[model samples]
Every structure is written in structure tokens, then in C-alpha cells.
Target: MSDRWQEMTVFVRVADSGNLSRAARELNLSQPSVSRIIGALEARLGTTLLLRTTRSISLTEAGSLYLERARYLLAEMEEAEQAARGIDSLHGVVRLAMPVLYGTRAVIPALATFLPRHPELRVEIVMSDARQNLIADGVDIAIRLGVGLLDDSAFGARKLAFVERLVVAAPAYLLAFSAPDNPADLARHSCIVQHGLFGRESWRFTHDQTVTSVDVQAKLWINSAPGVLAAAVAGLGIALATRVMAGEELRTGQLIQLLQPYRLDPAEVYAVFPAGPRPSAKVRAVVDHLEVALNTPS
Candidate 1:
């Protein structure tokens, strides 16, 4: 990489990671080398980009403005390279964000198969339940599962599939405690509640065109879907989960789906990307693969 472009890359990584050492580790360079790159970039620009201390680093006003433009320039450069190589060349890194369980169980398996065909491509998966800032984080794509995409004009979304939340428990748990016939009967049984974007205390269900929100009490409150599934499998309680997430368990008869009469709202899975230039071949290839992998029947 050229000196100026290399400096911009280091500056962007530092800004994203918020720590010089961490960014240096990611860039596979020594701390002093990374620090010097940033120092040189600031000197060349005649402006301070970061306010740093022993504990943390924060962006200066100029840093914030420069970071935005730097990202655009870097993206354009990458696109130029890809265009010069030919549109069919898939030889770049694709940073993807997804929820923990779905990314592990669904996305990774698909990638395991898709990646071998293109040895030059690399996928970095960020597993988190919280929404990520794509541009700021340097993420190329995000596989999101929810009611819909957040109202952000900066992102363009393509619907992948519709996934429904199902109340399920292990067969052992169901055999020990009689399953609830109706939503209200859930009050007398143990319920595992997940506390995040979907409300924890209130579980919404629809029946006969009438929607009902049941206020559920729980001894166990979990934030991650995998943890909740684990707790349910250990016979702790009935947990609410997305069908896509619990597909294997449900198919193998490890977990029994319950309360079929009542249904929760189906959430749409989306491949969200930055609203800028057209996606490079690497990004488009992975997005297309994920769309087919996620939507196709198992």
C-alpha cells in the first residue's frame, strides 16, 4: 500500500477499534509502527485526528470528518481495484454482522461450503445482537433478523426470508411438566425470557385474527439466543426462539414446539448494506449466497 493510503487505513482502524494496540494487532503491525503511521498522517494533514491517553482514544472533530471521507475514498479505491481486475473476480474481504446463534448455526455452515470455491475471499463475521454502524465499523454487509430494518437512510436492505418465533422446550421438560394449552396457561409454567430488542416481559401472540400480548414472568433472563436455547434444552423452561435458529433441534426431535394455536409475528431477515456505490463482487457474491442459503428449505 502507498504511504498515504496506508496511513488512512491505520487511522480508520484506530478510529474503529478505539485503541491503538488493538488496531495494531488487527493490522499485524507493532504498536510503535501503527502509532507512527497515525502521527505521520496527522503531521501531513496539519491537524490532530485523535485525542489519546493511557486508557482510551477519542476522535477529534477533524478526525470524525476525515474518518467519514477516508472511508469513502478507501471504498472507492477498493472498487477501482475490483473493477480493474474484472467484475467476476471475488478476491476481497467481506465484513459481515449477524446475531450470534444464526451466524453460528446458519451462516457459517453455508460459508463453509461457499468459501472453498473462492480461495482468495475472506469473510469476517461479527456476532452480536446489537445493531452495528456499518460505515463506522467497516462492515460490508449485515444479516439482520427482526420485524424490519431500522429506519436508517444510510443503508439499503434486501429481504432474505421470513422467520417466526416459536415457543419450544426439550422433550424431557415437556414430559415432566404438561405443556400449556393456551397463552394464559403459560403463567403457571416456567418461561425463559430473552431481554433485548424484542420485549422481555411481554410475549405477543396472534389467534383468530386477534392479537394478545401476554406478560410473562421468568426466573431466568437471557440476552443471547444460544444461551436461551441451551437453558431450555437443560430443561429449565419453555423458551421463545426463531424457527431458523432452532431448526436442527426441532427437526431432530430434541425440542418440541408448543402452543400451536397461538402464533407470534414473523420477522424478516435482511441483507443490509451501505447506501453508496454498487457492491463489489466479493460483497455481492456473499449476499447472493446467503440469500439462497437462508431462504432455501433445509
Candidate 2:
């Protein structure tokens, strides 16, 4: 059975590399040992899988079909091994990436309490509004705000929360400018615009089955969502912001919601990680903890 598994591994390597010598080098085995494994596999399967030549080796028709199944079986075995190990212990540094506002307003609270429970684990949170490549950036997990899942086949993305957006301005600002009665009124009002990773000025809203857009003429363009809120608080201009971020300000009357009848759909927040069979224990724990924290009533 051990030899059979070895043969399968060798067969997979050969199929992948397209040559026995290259596969042997990758597996740290001698050329003859690699060739013998393939020979044994072909004998067991009662078929020739490779066409060897002086210049190179190519897969036979049967080998081409078998290669895909072989890869799947190997991946499953690896996942089974990881799952067995996960039941015992989970300890590692988990690198996380997310937009600044969500990281500050939502994710931080969950991580603050979660980290204390697991002393052996370290969590690194990178707060940026930019969309980062998960694999290139070495991010174990990411939290993104949007309507649909990110189109990353290489990763697993799950919706974690819905965040409502609100147009808010200080009472003084509202009194000075007179709140906009409708979306069209925003054109006459000086608005504080947010220039996030997506862009500087486009915002969408819906009211009574009718969609309206305000092309905001900005007096101030800030790079961060929090910065835009701050501008609104200081009575600079009206700001469209997430309720998750502006909730305290609205409650305190520092900011009042404008165009209350026309509200934008809350941006969907997703917890994403590299797609795989068994998510790492550390990653799973963090995800579970975050859901609990975010869902709990404040």
C-alpha cells in the first residue's frame, strides 16, 4: 500500500513535469527510483501512461485523463492530514487586510477581544482602503465592502454584514445651507466627497422605486471615509457615509441624516480567505469570533 501511494505520487509528478528526470529531481529521488514507480503504476493500472522520447516525454491519452483525478486525490489526502492536525492545536500569525473604516469601526472590536483568548496566536491587521491582492500581499483573510463577492476564484469570500450608508451633516451646517429636499438639491450644496480606493466622487441612492444620482461638486475631497465624516462634523460640507461609521455622530446630533427618504443600500462586507478544502484552524476561529462580535447587540 505504501509503495502504491509512492507510485501514485510519482505518477502525478511525472504527469505534471512531463519528464521522469525532472519529477525525480523535484521529489528528491533518484531517476531510476522515479521511473520504477511509474512503471509499477502502469503495471497496476495495466496501461501505458507516458510516451518517452529522447527530447522529452508526453502523456498518453489515458495518462491525460488520469492526471486530473490523481491531483484531486492527492489534494484530498493533504486536506485530511491537515484536518487531523487541526483537531489538536492551532497556533500561528494570521495576517489580515481590510478597508480603514470597517477595520476601525467593526473589525477592531472583534479582534481586540478575540486576541486575548488565544495568547499563542498573533493577528496583524492592515488598514487600507485599497483593494489588495490576497496571495501577493500574503493576507490570510480580508474584509471588503461591496455588492457582490470579489471575483477571486483562488479565494473563499463570504458575506459577513450589511452596512447602510447615510448622508449626514452637522446641525449648524444643515441650518446654514438648508438641508437638500431632494437629490437634485445636492448640486447646489457644497458636499464633502470621499475618494476611496474605488474613486473620488460617484455615490448611488434609491427612493420610492426611483433611482437618483447627485453629481457632487466637492469643496473637499478626502482619501479616507473617517476623514470625510470629520469634514462633515466640522460643518465643512454634507457627507455621505456609512451608518456603521457615523452612528455615534448621528446619535449625538453632531450629524443629521439628509435625504432620509432616499437611502443607499448598505455596502456588503465579506470575510474572505484563500479557497481550499479545510480552512486553517486559526483562520476559522477568527472568522467565527468576528461573526459573533459583529452580530451581538450594542
Candidate 3:
């Protein structure tokens, strides 16, 4: 690699690993050499990018901005090289961020065939339901499920699938408690809720130009999506769940769909990534595979 390329690569590694020794180990360089490279880069830029301390390392304002641009430029250069080499399947680690349940149930399973096709590629997955900082986290692609507005200038997003959500109950539960006739009737029944996403406080439903938000009585509040469905199957209470999450149960008659007359506000699933001129080959491949996999209903 060229001198500038080496500098940027080392800097990024240092920033990501958050330790000089670890970055040195990763780069196969001495710890003192890593420190010198960072120092020299700061001198060349005439500004400090990282503030290093004994306990932790943090990015300065300039460092954060620089890292974003550096990551983009590196990907672009790597893509150019691959194109010049006439390579079809690219080799590199593509770090992905996604929701836990979605990763387990959909994303991972969908990539089974596609992953084997690319023998040189490596995939690392970080799963969480919370919103992630794409650049700061070094995430190449993030699969998100929501209906909220997105910032156009900062990130790029592609619609993957329409998330079908609804209220559901166990056959046994409905035997004891009457099924909800409308959105408003949910307040009279017990509900199972998952934390860290929408519907924790209230569930929204729509019917022909009308929207209804119902405050549910949370008899059981859990953090896991699967746990929420399990609660409903156990006849604990009604659950607000995505059709994908409740597919098997709904099909097997373990859970009964409710509030059919009212339409639940569907969440839009997206493959979100940093805004750039173009996505790298690996990132695009994963996104394309997911787009096809998510759209094909199982």
C-alpha cells in the first residue's frame, strides 16, 4: 500500500479498535509505530483528530468528519481496483447492523445461498433494535424496521419490504375474553408489549382515512420480540406483532389475528447505509440479496 493509504488504514483501525496496542496488533506494526503514524498524520492535517487518554480514545469533531470521508474514499478506491482487475466476486469483510429478531429469522436465513456464492467474502453482524450511527459504528449496512421519517442528506435508505403488523391473541385467551371489535376496544383487554420500539405506549390503527391510537393495558411487558409472541401463545394477553414474527403461530392456529376491520399502521423495512456516490460491491450484493429475499413471502 501507498504511504497515504497506510496512514488512513492505520488511523481507521486505531479509531475503530479504540486502543493503540490493539490497532498495532491488527496492522502487524509496533505500538510505537502506530503512535508515530497518528502523530505524523495530525501534523500533516495541522489538527488533532483523536483525543487519546489512558483509559479511552475519542474522536474530536474533526476526527468524526474525517473518518466518514475516509471510509467513503477507501471503499471507492477498493471498488475501482476490483473493477480494474475484472473481478466478479469481491473479497472483504462487510459489517452489517440489524435488529436481533430480523437477523435471526430473515436476514441470516435469506443470505444462506448468497453467502456460499461468494467464497472470499466475510460477514460480521451486529444485532440491535435501537437506531445505530452508521459511520461511527463502522457499519456497512443496517436493516431497520420503522415508519418514521428519515434524514435525506445524511444517509441513504432503500425500501426492502412492507412490515405487516397487527394485534393477535391465543385461542384460549379469546375464549375467556372477547376479541376486540375495534381499535378502541383494546383498552378493555390485557396486552403483551415489547420494549424499545413503537407500540409500547399505544398501538395505532387505520380505517379508510381515519387513524385510531389505542392505549393498551399491558399485563405483560417484555423486551424480546419472540417473548412477546410466546406470551400470546401462552394465553397471557393480546400482542402487537409483525406478521413475519407471528407467521408460524398464525399459520398453526396457535395465535388468532384480531382487529381485522382496522388496519394497523404498517412499518416500512429499510436497508439503510451512509450516503455516498455509490455503494461498494459487497454492500450492494448483500442489499440486493436481502431485497429479493425479504420481498419473496415465505
Candidate 4:
């Protein structure tokens, strides 16, 4: 049983590390020994769990399923050990990943109340628009705002909110220049483009079950959502923004929604964590707090 547990632990580390040598070094085991243990386990199971290459290793279909179960088992084992040792308190740092603007507007404010209650728990926030490798980056929880999940098997996600993208501009700008009557009219206006994965110059809109793409001309190209909001509020140009990102501006009439007849694709907000057994207490606490805070009226 101890040997089985060791094999499970080693396999998990190898999966997480994505390199046998790195996993071996971290486990304080020889490379050959780690390789042999994995080989032995694969042979015993009569299936290949990982596909190895010269530079990297990846899980097979069977491997992915087995990995999920293995993580659950390991987590349960760890919980059992912690319980036996009487370490019931939730403490230690949880590394969280999220987009910068959303983290600033939604996540940080939520944690203001949450952090005070859990005096022993610390949190490290990784704010970026780029997709982060959860295992490589050691992220404990990730908050994603997007149309859908990129990889469902990799993490367990809980839906926090449904968000919408809005094409908006400062009321002053709209008064100075004619507002776009439709998606195509954006070509004649100065558009603030977000040059990222969502596309810089191309904006998509849907109406009456019809979808259209507009090749927008941008006088300003910004990578950050906050920057886009700031520029729009300053009456520089029109911008595409998420409702949550511009919630305050919209509420205070600093920005007005444009082309209301057409709608951009709605995005879902999710709190994701590594696929395993139930999440640790600290993870659950933060996720729970975010769920309520984000879902509440802004």
C-alpha cells in the first residue's frame, strides 16, 4: 500500500512537472528510478498513462482520466494525514490568477472583507490577460472571464456570473460625433481597439440570429481593459468593454452604450482550480466569497 501511494505521488508529480527530470529532482529521486517506477506502474495497469518525447511528456486519453482520479486520491490521503495530525485550521498562501482589470474591480474588493476574517490565510494574486499554465505557475485558483472553457478536463470550474460585452463611448463624444447606428457604421468612427487574443481591429456583433464582423479602424490600440475604459471616458474614442469593466462608468453616465440593437457574445465568469478531489479549505473559502461578491449588484 505504501509502495502504491509512492507510485501515485511520483506519477502526479511527473504529470504536473511535464518533465521526468524535473519531477525526479523535486521528489529527490534518481531519474532512472522515477522512470522505472512509472514503467512498472504502466505495465501493471496494462496501459500507457503518458506519452513521452525527447523534450516533453503528455497524458494520453486514459492518462487524463487516471490523472484526475489519482489527484483525488492523493488529496484525500493528504487530508487524512492532516486530520490525523490535528491540523484543521485553514492557513497558508493561495496563489490566484485572473485578468488585471477584473481582479482589480471585482476580486480585490471581494477579498477586502474576506482577508480580514481569515487572518492566518494569505493570498498571492497573479494578474494577467495571457493564459497561465496552472501547474507550471503554481496557481491555486484562477478566475476566468470568457465565452467558454478552453480545456474542461484540466480544471474544475464553477460559474460565477454571466457577463456581456458592450460597445460604449463617452457621452461627450457621442454628442460631438454621430453614434454608430449599426456595426458597419463603426468604420467611420474612431474606435479604441484592444490588441490581444480577442482581436484588435475586428469586432463581432449579433442581431436577430445574424452575426456580423466589422473591420474597425482604431486611432488608439491598448492592451489593457482599464486603459480602454479610461480613454473612452476621456472622450478619446469609442471602445469595446465588458459590462463589469465599465459598470461604474455606465452607472454614473460617464459612458453610454452604443448600437444597443446588436449584442456582442456573452461571456461567462468562472472560478477554476486544479482538477482533484474537493478543493482545500482555503481555496473553497476564497471561491465562495468571490461567488457572492461578484454575483451581487455592483
Candidate 5:
């Protein structure tokens, strides 16, 4: 029974990774060893689970069905072990995909506490601002910050926190002109827009129970949050930045927070995981820890 489960686990890893050599490195087995295990498992089942060539590995129809069942069964086995041994049973690699700057500046530091408590587990962070398909990327959890998860029906999500954003500029830029005293002043300034996140070159602010929206005329539109902040630090233009992304820079005076008192509505942060079956204990623990880390006072 143990051998059967290990076979399923190996099959699942290979299917997820799409490369036997990559799966071999992840599983700490040689490439030939992983190939042999897959071959032996397929022979026992009397069907080919994968279509492999010199370039890539893909699941056959039988492999697709088997992959689903294998994931479900492995998740169940982990849960059963958890019920038997509590937190000590949580051992394995958990892959987390997150935005580049937010994950590095805000989320990663917080994991310092969570990791020591689970030394048996390993966490791998895949960082990108672009959205990732969790199952296709073999990610256990993805951290997202935005207005909403409108099209993500294939995943289950937990809200972590709402992060307030700020309008900021470098000391050098302010020296050239002057800091924006109000939202309307941003319209006259050169703004560094993050096109991917906000889409429209616009900024929103609130004051005295009233809301204000301003359109920005930006010569440069950056697709990355970090890229936008980098432009601001270089005095290229003013930027709308999240506190999470600019915390260190603001503290060091590389970037100065602008437009006092008024603030943009906080963006929503989420921990998204695949939709089927209860998440493994390690996944749940990591998500829970992120909620604490992000929401905790800095």
C-alpha cells in the first residue's frame, strides 16, 4: 500500500512538472530513476499515462484522469496523517506564487516565523506580477492583490487583507516642482502608471466623506508594480504605490509619500488555491500564516 501511494505521488509530480528531469530534481531522484518508476507504474496499470518525447511530457487522457484521482487521494492521505499526528505530520514542498515586490518586501519577511515552526516542510516562492494558473504552474497557493477575483472560478480563495495605496514621489522630483497638495495636482504631474494592475491611468482618493477620482497623463505606463516604483525613485514621475511595495523606500526617504491624509481605497489581497478537494494541511497553514503576517502591524 505504501509503495502504491509512492507510485501515485511520483506520477503526480511528473505530470505536474511536465519534465521527468525537473521532477527528478524536485523529488531528489535521478532522471533515469524517475523514468523507470513511471514506466513500471504504467506497465502495472496496462496503459500509458504520459506521452513523452525529447522536448516535453504531456498527460494522455488516461493520465489526466489518473492525475486528478492521484491528487485527491494524496490530499486525503495527508489529511488522514494530520488527523493522526497533528501538525508534526505536515512535511513536503509547498509552492507559492506571488507578485514580485509585494511577496519579497511584505510577505516573505513574515514567513520567518512560520518556517521555523515547520522545519520539516520546504517553501518555494515563484515570483511574478503576471497572473499564473495554479494547477498548470504546479503552485500550491498564489497571492493576489487587486480589486476582485472576477474570472477565477477554478480556484478557492481566502481574503488576507486590504492594503492601502499611496501617491509618492522622490525628493528630487519634489525639489524640481512641489509635492501635490491634492488629488487634482497629480493630473499636472508626470505619473508613472502601472498599466497591468489599474489599467486606466487614474488615481482615486477620499476626503471628508467624499470620494475623488483623478485622471493621470503619463508618458510611461509600466506593467510591473516594482517597475513603477523604480521610476518614481529615479524622479521620472510620481507613482501610485502600495505601502507594502514602498515601505522600505519610504522609511529610507528614497521615496516620499505625497498627498497627505487622503488615500486610495485599499486593494484586496487573497490566497488562492485549486478548487477541488480540501487543501493539504501545509497549504492551509501557509495561507493562515500569510493572513497573520500581512494583517499584523508593521
Candidate 6:
């Protein structure tokens, strides 16, 4: 009898990657082992699946037919595996990726309550704004805030909330210089631009369903949110910042909102994970617990 399940997995990986070397790397197996599996699968079927060349590999007619069925079978097997392990009680380490500000303010605080419930569970958080591959990085979950989540492959994501951005300036700065009324007016002001992970300096705004992108060069440039907030509060210049990061300052009158009619693009925060893998009890619990915690303001 053919080892159909194992063969299907190897087939699916090779087809998706379109290269033996990448499939082997992703599977954490040697190239020879991958080749052997493919050879066995072709032998059982008594036909050539992949047409190999010195420089590249191409799928034959048989390979194309096999790939579709193989993917479905592999997906079904993964679902079954998840269903079999659906119980809530679990124990293991969960690697997490989160933006720095949220990691410090929201995620860490929620973990304090969650950790008690799962005494055997451990969490290692990689706090960064840069995106990384969850599987390659060994991450169980990633707390992301931005537009790149939709484009990611092999990941499942759930939106937590909308993160709005606002342009603000300290009271002293506003008194010294006029605040911008609209996107175009920003050009006359000294803007403090934040160069985030995506190398974005331009801000997006929407008015009456019409979107406009404003590129305001900054007199002062900063990479971190905390530094930007400080600079705005110290009357350095007008800063565009996330509502969550600048909430305290805005409430206390340290900074005043600018351009009320035009609003910046809102980013959604999501808890992302590997799509095929069933989350362990620890990961599931943390995701559930934090959703409630972050949604509720303390």
C-alpha cells in the first residue's frame, strides 16, 4: 500500500513552493529526503509528476492533477488533527510577535492575568514593528497593526480593533505656529514625521469617500512613537501618531488635534497565526483573553 498521506504532504509542499530546495527548507528536511519522497510518490503512481531540469522544475500534466487533490487532502488532515486536539487544557511555550508600544502597554498587562490560568505555559514576545515570517521565526502568534496582514501567506488573522491616526501639536507649538486645517496646509508647517517599518513618510487621508495622500517633509524625523510623542509634547512640531499611543497626551491637553475634517488612514490590529496549525490551548487562551482586555479600557 502507498503511504498516501506522507506522499500528499510532500507533493503539496513541492507544488506550492515550485522548487525542491525551498520545500525541503520549509519542511525542515534534507533535499535528498524530499527527493526520495517525490520519487516514491511517482513510482507508486507509475508516472512522472514533476519534470526536472538542470535549472528548474516544472509540473507535468499528472503533477498538476495531483497537486489539487493533494492540497485538499492535506488540508482535511490538518483540520482533523486540530479537531482531535480541541480540548482547552494545554502546556507549552508560545512565541509571539507584537509592535513595541502594544507589547508594553496592552499585551504584557493582559498576560499577567492569563499566565495564572496556564501555569505551565510560557510566552516569548518579539516586540518589533518589522514583519517576520511566523513559521520561519517559530512564532505561535503575532499581534500586528497595519495593512500588510492581508497579503501574508500561510497565516490566519482576526481583527481586534481599528487604530486611528491623528495629527497633533503641543499647546505651545500651536500658539507659536498655526495648526493645519487640511492636508494641503501641512506643507507650511514643520511636521515631525515617523519613519515606520514600511519606510512611510506620507500620510493618507479620506474626505467624503475620496482619498488623498499627503507627503509632508519633516523638520524633525524620528523612528519611534514614544520619541515622536515627546517631541510633539515638547513643542518641537506637529506629529502624526496613533490614537492609542497619544491618548494620554491628548486627554491631558499636552497635545491638541489638528485637521478635524480630514482623517488619516486607520490601521487594524490583528492577532495572526499559522493558518493550518491548530492553536494550542495556551495560544487560544491568550488570544481570547487579550481580545477582551484590549477592547476594554483600564
Ranking by TM-score: 3, 5, 1, 4, 2, 6
TM-score each candidate. Answer: 0.84, 0.67, 0.86, 0.71, 0.85, 0.66
TM-score winner, 2 or 6 = 2
* Off by more than 4 A, model 1: 126-142, 146-159, 197-199, 270-281
Candidate 1 local lDDT, 30-88, one digit each (tens):
99999999999999999999999999899999999998888788878987888897755
Q: Can you tell me which runs of candidate 2 are displaced by over 4 Å?
A: 1-88, 147-154, 197-200, 274-278
- lDDT string for model 2 (1-298, tens) is 4886787778876765566777787678999988888888898899999999887778899997887677567657655665886633445578788888778888897778878777777788888876665544556688877655466765677677777788889998877878889888888888887664323355577998988766877889888877887889999998878787888898999999988899876777778875332355677788888887876766
Give lDDT tens digits, candidate 3, residues 112-212: 97888888899989888766666656677888876574554567778888888878999999999998888888899998988755436688888987988
Question: Each candidate: what lDDT?
Answer: 0.82, 0.76, 0.82, 0.83, 0.84, 0.75
Instruction: Please identify which of the two predictions, 1 or 5, would achieve the higher lDDT against the true structure.
Output: 5
**What C-alpha lDDT, on a 0 to 100 scale, does residue 258 get in candidate 6?**
89
| TM-score: model 2 vs. ground truth | 0.67
10 residues in a row with least lDDT, candidate 6: 274-283
Ranked by lDDT, the better of candidates 5 and 6 is 5
Residue-wise lDDT of candidate 4 within 1-298, one digit each (tens)? 4878888988988898788887787678999999999998899899999999998899999898888889788778767754764533556678899988888888898888788877777898999877778776657788887664546575777888877899999988998999999999999999897645344587889999999999998999887777888999999999988887898999999999999999988777888876442776668778988889988886
Root-mean-square deviation of candidate 1 = 3.2
On lDDT, who's better, 4 or 6?
4
Off-target runs (Cα >4 Å) in candidate 6 are 1-88, 133-136, 148-150, 197-199, 208-210, 274-278
Candidate 5 regions off by >4 Å?
132-137, 149-151, 181-184, 198-200, 206-213, 274-277
The whole-model C-alpha lDDT of candidate 2 against the native structure comes to: 0.76
Better of 2 and 6 by lDDT: 2
